[model samples]
Target: MKIGKQDATYQLERFSKTQAEFDEHYEKDLQPIAEKLEEERQKTMSLAKEQAKKLIIPALVALAMIIFFDGFRIYVIAALAAYGAYLFKDVYEQRKKMRVKIKEQLLTALIQFLNPNFTYKPKSYVHRNQFIKSNIFKDDPNRYSGDDLIKGFVGNDDVDANGIKGTKTELSFSEIKAEKVEKYKDKNGKTQERVTTIFQGMIFVVDFNKDFEGLTTVVPKQKGLKISLPRFLSGEKGRRLEEVELEDMEFMDKFTVRTTDQIKARYILTPGFMRRLYEFATKKREVQPQNTQKPETLKEAVKVGLNVGGDQRRASQDARNVAYFSFRDGKMYFLLSTGKEHFESGLLTPINKSLVQEYYEDINKSLELVDELNLNLRIWSKE
Candidate 1:
């Protein structure tokens, strides 16, 4: 199941459609959907503004009561809280529906334009079982949820490297949020549960239609340091896996490879593959904000800062853009730890061209990973 250089080039060419071509698709198919959603958005906001205007007088009265009438202050605050909720409940529900519409109607159409054969499911996600089976993370998450699932096939469907007609490369990914909840006692001696995020990003799994006999896990050097440490020293309760030492010092500096079979580990982590993995892990892709509406409140500003992930590298070299790779069961499982939330619409802004472009690029980047790792080369197999 291996392909030659010419076949590999052909596969790359087949999958690499220029951004201009996608822009054409966006203008033709997706633009109308966005425009229609914008119209609904305008109507919804108009009604919301009118309802919100009624709050100003009540708010002023509440403020005056707090200053002049101390006894009635609590009652006035409670009354205002209930009234505000009643006024905005419809608007909140409408905006919620609009978010769903953007994902279902607009994003779905964009995915179709990218590849008619590809399937986009907004509600479904990769199962938790697959995450556990990969064994990339040491601790299993107590809570798991995700959305924006994209599943499809790449490679030349017309002919295989051996002149057979079939596609061997299949790609699937989803935005996952996995967390671990731990219980602890506070200073008051009362037990409380603290939720810790284990992983928050995309879990990309590729079925390369090739088989491997060993499980090889590649983690960032810092994490590798912890895992590769002796059991007596680190107190690691997981399965003991031997570290695979490769000839490339640069790759070894950036990543730690642990495997069950030495020969198979070397077979997969060749010099070129190691270089690619290093570059992919070190390089940061910063996605600029698509929404034009600036944040008015401090909370909104803080949220925007986190979401855009301002252009700053981590203080530590090993801590920047951490990526994990596990090769097992004839599939390559990649866990990308991007802290920002992907493919979400801004609540304050209507759908626009820039927003649509952002979604397109975000998704297109994920699809390009197959080529980035040279997975379509099919240089080895389980035979």
Candidate 2:
């Protein structure tokens, strides 16, 4: 289901209908598993409570004895703690394994219900090299780690009855974390090392149906003190790349476009295409109220670096507002800092109809970007 300008509403309606069917299937199929999980959870909780109750009195008694006899205080506390750990170790391990199993099962079931063709890996993730090739984030490949990768096609591979051709788009998203160690001095003037998060969010990659050899990066505009910084100091190496300017004032105001070739950038970022990017960025900002509370206007949003992808050297840059865009090898990668965990099944909450609807909506939101950004509408490019 390609969501075009004229049929956005209709595509959503169709998705809603499909989601309703999935919801019914979920209730019918997953209810038994949910019930079993609930039972196991209650049993685990009861066992933990009983174990804690049995240990608390002894631990308190040991503490009181230590206060009276200072000689054996350390030994007494250590003994009590060791004993408590020994008592609960098996139960804790058992519960942990059970939870992992349940989580994997639920995720698999939910993903299958959404689309039988799709595959969900509870432990796999998008590779760091892929992130670098995507040019979404400017962190060292050694610093990147990710997990929980979901990949598959959405919509139909065949043409639908409405005369609309279904897109065979390959979509994948994963939770990514990139960190670097910084050496700094504390208040006491002693040098210390601290780990800083360079990028922590979901990185999404979609196959763009068209193949292009050049790289086009659309980052947020930089101004003020940042503009005066040297390329080396700024930690960005693509200064030699031509900065292409689009005709749309709003898009130009929102994004700083760069490409290996100026003509290719212009062809890729058409007025209609830039408008779609602007709209997507605007929608993402609006969804995150915590970050966009002060920016009331779209221009202000862009000025504050509301779009993804910004100057990597700006330490004070807000990761939530930044998204990185990269085009390479017939694929479009979008690095979004949503600042929250996604596709997680709750421990206590069952996978209900509403929950399934939310998952469906999120998947569609990602897929729609392929069409909305005009990724398939290639110009001056060979497929």
After superposition, which runs of candidate 1 have C-alpha atoms over 4 Å from their true positions?
A: 1-11, 14-16, 69-75, 156-165, 223-239, 287-321, 381-383
lDDT of 2 at 174: 77
Q: Please write out the lDDT profile of model 2 over residues 128-242, one tens digit for every residue.
A: 7777676544445456777678788654445567865555667888778776777899999999988866666778888866656667877666643122211121134653556
Poorly placed runs, candidate 2 (over 4 Å): 1-6, 9-26, 62-81, 155-167, 182-193, 221-239, 284-322, 343-365, 374-383
Task: Go through the candidates in order and give each one's C-alpha lDDT.
Answer: 0.70, 0.61
- Name the top lDDT candidate: 1
Cα-based TM-score, every candidate: 0.81, 0.70
Q: How many clashes in each candidate?
A: 0, 3
